[model samples]
Target: MKAKILIVLGLLLLNFGLQAKEKECIKLHVGHNEVPENLIEKKKSITHTHHLSGHEPVHIENHFGDVKVRVWEKPEVKVNIEITANAPSEKKVQAFLEIVKIHSEKVNGEIHFKTDLQCLASAFENNINGGDDKEERNFLRVDYEVWMPEGHDLTVENSHGDVYIPRFLSVLNLHQNYGNLFADHLKNERSVIDLNFGKGFIKSMKGGQLNARQTALLIDKAENVVMTNTSGNVKVLMADHVDMKTSYGSGHIDKVSESCRFQVKYAKEFILGEIMADVDKLEIESSHTNLELPLCVKGRYDLSTNTRNTDLVLKDQPKVHYITTGNDAEKRMLIGTTTETNATKVRVTSSYGRVEVK
Candidate 1:
């Protein structure tokens, strides 16, 4: 019996030891790999400063990295570029760094800065031809930080990265994809933005045009602007003389001071919060939509619906004249008018949806 007990204790100790050893092996396997000296990342920085004549347009193009632009009081354009290359060996990294470059020049009175990665294709082809499997871990990226004078026309194009501009007081032409744009204030004669698969946040815009696809845009205040979106959502807190078009999306306009027009199709919901008394014209056309609008007592509204429901809540305005024609089975027309002499003209048309006016 004593020999049997001793054998059992030995087996239990062995099992515990095996468990501890297995845990240690797993911990070591999950740990991060130590980087070798040859495999360390190589970095390079290039800076260029050009004294501008204050009338030249600055254009920048980048891919696979971020671009940040800020305004300065100096009459010069300064660009700082950071390049990073990583590969399996120091020699491979050096090869990649040799081909990746930034090309900057003055062409037709325009300052142009572009990322030159065309030679990388040849480098990759050479690696494939040589049957090198180490190219799989090779990567190169370039980022830009630019500072320029105010009132200069600036254009930037980027892909797979973010673009940030704090305050731009000039014409801006910004195009981006698979990224986001954050602008504090853009004030100028004209600004155009084209974005896809991204989000845009503009705190204030004086006059601009925005074209977006699969994006969400938020503007705190916009004046004399035109916006078009596809499969996106737009929200504007204060809009003046703005025209907006959205398809397969949604929109919300909190307040309108001058004039506004909205065109929405296949939208989830569209809401217009309020219209000031100074508004001259307000128009809305929608299909397959759910919309909500505020009824103004000093306005003349002409509403038409085709095969849909209309809910007009006029509990507070008893002095208003409201009329309805046609039955619920077909197209219907409703007109509401107040006794105000300089009443604003409001038109709303909808099909196969609901309209709620209060």
Candidate 2:
């Protein structure tokens, strides 16, 4: 009996191993390649820290690599930078490092820090001005980890890589391209962020107003939000007022306290969650997309659909009074609802798309 049990256990283990290998093999077939370790060189690092006497804004701009900024209670600031260059040979790495300069200066109580890429910029300018058309064959990556005092303002900009900030209580201006951004907590009156192409996630952000533009955004809590995007997805859990404009994207917000407004230019899917009667207005306009709303509406609504179908699914035990109208000759439909005490007004317009309510 012991020998039989051992054989069965060995077969099971072998089957599991084969399944894991098969999964990995499938991943490889789908454009996943494993590169050898010796092809890339190790990163070079430079670190520095400083103490400041005044509370002025600090600015950091990097070309390529990640940037992380944090806040602490101490009265000092610390910075750590990592640099990596990719080339065919070690001589090229040394030559590239000689041209790039890392500069940090304190001017009038403000700290300015950056990795200046003047050499490449000059090369590009020369190439554009009828000079040698030889392209730049080298690239530099600089990553930063910085910690500053709490309540200190910051202005950070990067071209490529992720940007992360744990907590901040002052003004913030962050811009980036082709990387993700994350913020844990924010306690500012207003903050501005713009990204060319990347995803952004914010949690527990409490502010009077916020303006964010990116490819994709996900937020847990926010207030007075204004966002614009070209093509991506947006999800919000709880917010007071949201105004959004998207060319091609989808949105889902769980709860809106005051108002929700969206202007979509192309095919986009928008979904809404619970809505209170205290909300003044809810307006949505889409060109060729589907819009879904909750079934239980507490106040009043006015919805219209053009060249498409409209579906309204009511609850088993309904409370509000609903009135609907349609013009079959013009292929247009209108729906309206009302409440007793707190009246909410919702207006939606769609062209060549469906409007679903449930």
Candidate 3:
């Protein structure tokens, strides 16, 4: 009878030991990474290189915080995770890691996690985008610092964290609904950035051949540029081959060396700084705004403008078709200089603003 009791107690202790073994704790050094210049005073970015053992599906998710992940090839696939944090204390970091352990799960294999003395929530503010006026910021703030090899497929999502990467080459798709995301440049094309902003700002690519889309886009001296925006200040300088679209913002294009294309729907005003290129097509819908364009193009162009101001002018005949849609005051504005030969087609439509060829 005593032997049976002893055996039962041993099995119970074994079960508790196995359960504890499944939960592991890790610590990281706090002086390894660089936070932003402004954030360095208030917060810090900590880098960590963690490892995972065996095949376990590792899931790390943060609600309103920054997150970064990297995978590398070392005979066996090692998951090295790096985190930049604005956490306050070592004790808080330990507590936050415990919270992370409760939520972190191993799907592919077992993970040996390592992090810094600060909590992950210290990296960014944890304010949800809308309708969350009653909750406190109990989650951790984590600014992300991720680096992977050439072919790691990763997906990152956040609520109030801005995504910033200095350099990395991996298949990455990211979206930030309420913060400004910035990437200096991609070293190679293996890295793909898919980003969105809610009320914050977004600055994706500076120069070089980049494929970028923004709710409110901004560009300065880009080679091949494509910009779309709702209502934000946009500036373009001496460059070429730009395809642009806007709803209710001003566009300034100057000294473009090649043929450019622009489609503006509802802008309060329009400004063409200097059009020194042969335009392929400058199709504009000036609903209740002003219009301006250069006199010539290399090939064909579809020029259309609707203005309230009746004194409109076109100094040359367009090579393609000149289609006008508006009142008689809009039609009488297409005045030309030459008795006319081969010129790019110019179309005019006026409802409420002036049109000019400058």
Quick one: how many clashes does candidate 3 have?
A: 29
Alpha-carbon TM-score of each model against the true structure: 0.76, 0.72, 0.51
lDDT at position 293, candidate 2: 75
Comparing 1 with 3 on TM-score, the higher-scoring candidate is 1
Better of 1 and 2 by lDDT: 1
lDDT of 1 by residue, 133-236 (tens): 33233455677999998868999998767889888888999999877888888887588999898899999888889899999999999888888989999999
lDDT tens readout by residue for model 3, 284-333: 44555565665443432335444564456554545323445555444422
Worst 10 residues of 1 by lDDT: 1-10
- State the displacement of the C-alpha of residue 91, model 2, in Å, after optimal TM-score superposition: 2.8
Clashes of each: 0, 1, 29
What lDDT does the true structure give each of the candidates? 0.71, 0.62, 0.41
lDDT of 2 by residue, 58-157 (tens): 8888765688997777787778888765434465445444545678888778888888744444333323221211132334567899989976788889
Candidate 1 residue 262 Cα shift, in angstroms, is: 0.8
Q: Which stretches of candidate 3 lie over 4 Å from their true place?
A: 1-97, 100-139, 151-156, 165-172, 185-216, 221-227, 238-241, 292-351, 354-356
C-alpha-based local distance difference test score of model 1: 0.71
lDDT of model 2 at residue 8? 10
